[model samples]
Target: MRNLRITLIFSIIILTISCKNKEVKSENKNSNIGQFRFIISDTLAYGKNLARISEYNRKLKENESSVIAVIIENELEDGSTKIDTFSDGLKTPFFGISKYQTGKHKIEIKVEEKMMRTKKLPNDSLSLEIKDIYYTYKFHVFIKDKVYISELNEILSKQMDIEYNENPI
Candidate 1:
């Protein structure tokens, strides 16, 4: 009888701990102090642009909770605007959009702060570096005269602290 009672107590403690952990995890997923967006500049032709957009959009839709619609707006020499897009939906309450191009380019981040609030960090290693990591709500990238809107939802950034200018020289 004593052994059974001890086992029952242990089981109750374990179940309580697990329930608390699950609650914390769900809360963290929705907590956000603010959001940001990325502006990248590159130069790619229309065909190349289309291919990149298709591949990136496919990957984002498959991976993330939010689906991004990539809008390609080209400013013609005659002052007419040409626009092309992939996917369809309203862009709001988005998880994030990624950077479209690789290598050197001018990239700017604009953070829209919600409200300042202090919160404890997660014990996981990834959460330790979350502040340095910027999450983009929607991306508006300019490759030459063509503007790619929310073309991607992932950025392959090697270093978080680094910045690139339009012209280094």
Candidate 2:
């Protein structure tokens, strides 16, 4: 009867410890639920004018599944614009241009998983532009005009590298 009592006491102590540990883990998991954000930039120049490229904001959130959003803004007048959204299985690209004859413009992009509410990985963006120039002669002098065309490539090469290092996706 003494051995039976000792065995019951040991089992009760073990069960109590397991219940406490589970509570601690549940609290830790709740503390990490939120969205993350980052920023990126690039530049191009021609003659006396300069074109600047910067993202509005980069954000990732955990919902029914993982969702990533990228916001891109351009600060140039007369230049064009473009946006691209990318993931492991799909790619989407969009294009636009400045509204006025000269000034600043913006474009926004959002990406999310089809279904699920869990953790999410990191994402990337690539901005590119080609400037074209035309010249005409008047009064034995040359006059030059320029235009900008923009494109966004949804290439996740850098993200792949990070994943290769055993980092979060």
Please name the candidate that would achieve the greatest TM-score relative to the true structure.
2
lDDT of 2 at 93: 15
Model 2, 1-169: lDDT tens digits are: 4433433343333322211111111111111212222121121122122111222232323222222222223334455544432333211212221233332212232323122222224573222221111111111111123454222112233344454466332
Which ranges of candidate 2 are over 4 A from the true structure? 1-34, 42-83, 89-103, 113-169
Tens-digit per-residue lDDT, 127-166, candidate 1: 1110111122222334432353324322322111122232
lDDT score, candidate 2, position 96: 21
In lDDT terms, which candidate is top?
1
TM-score of 1: 0.20
